[model samples]
Target: MITARYHREIPQRYRLEAGKCKKCGFIAFPHRLVCPKCKSQDFETIRLSDEGKILTFTIVRVASDKFSKQTPFAVGIVELKEGVKLTTQIADVDVDKLEIGQKVKIVFRKIQEDGKAGILCYGYKAVLI
Candidate 1:
């Protein structure tokens, strides 16, 4: 069964939709009921930019069971052109050559599976530009 949280996050996971606070121009990924900056309740739905630059990164040589098959993957904090920062797996590149400030573009990809016959979860991953 899909949890409400998972259902609620489909927009962010699939389309990178965020909420822009009307009062202070703050963008919240996965949105929020209240603006974290200005404590305002008003917001406007916005789509985040797909392009970004890696601020920092690390090679995950050891990963959990769910991701062990994809070990030695790179994960990074990417700051989108709109200035919203998010942690995402960096894919389709050599981990050793990854550097801070490297340009990347977000893409939809399979994230993981829940069980033997479980649902396949999908989400955004960054690829070198």
Candidate 2:
């Protein structure tokens, strides 16, 4: 059985779906029922931009058990063209050369697996453009 958290994130993880506040034009990633900015309950589903620029980054030398094998990776807060910012792991680049303001594009990739069931979890990762 898929975990609740994983099942809950299917839309955002697979299609990059977000909720846009119909009343105030605020976009919320992961689709919130209530708009944080204007406290509005009305929202429209929207797809986020696939391309973005790195706003800030950090090199992860240590990571949780599920991700330890991929340590020394670069993770960054990317600002999509629509102005939505999301934290994602930067892949397919030299970690030493990563910098803020660098261009990147999101790509679907395997994230990790469920221990005993060997369930493969997939999600988005950013690559230099």
Off by over 4 Å in 1: 1-4
Query: Against the correct fold, how does model 2 do in TM-score?
Result: 0.94
Compose the digit string of candidate 2's lDDT tens values, residues 33-94: 99999999999999998999999999999999887888888889999988999999999999
Overall lDDT per candidate, in order of appearance: 0.93, 0.91
Q: Name the candidate that leads on lDDT.
A: 1
Per-residue C-alpha lDDT of model 1 across residues 38-87, encoded as one tens digit per residue: 99999999999999999999999999988898998999999999999999
Q: List the residue pairs that clash in candidate 1.
A: none
Candidate whose TM-score is highest: 1
Instruction: Name the 10 consecutive residues with the lowest summed lDDT in model 2.
Output: 111-120
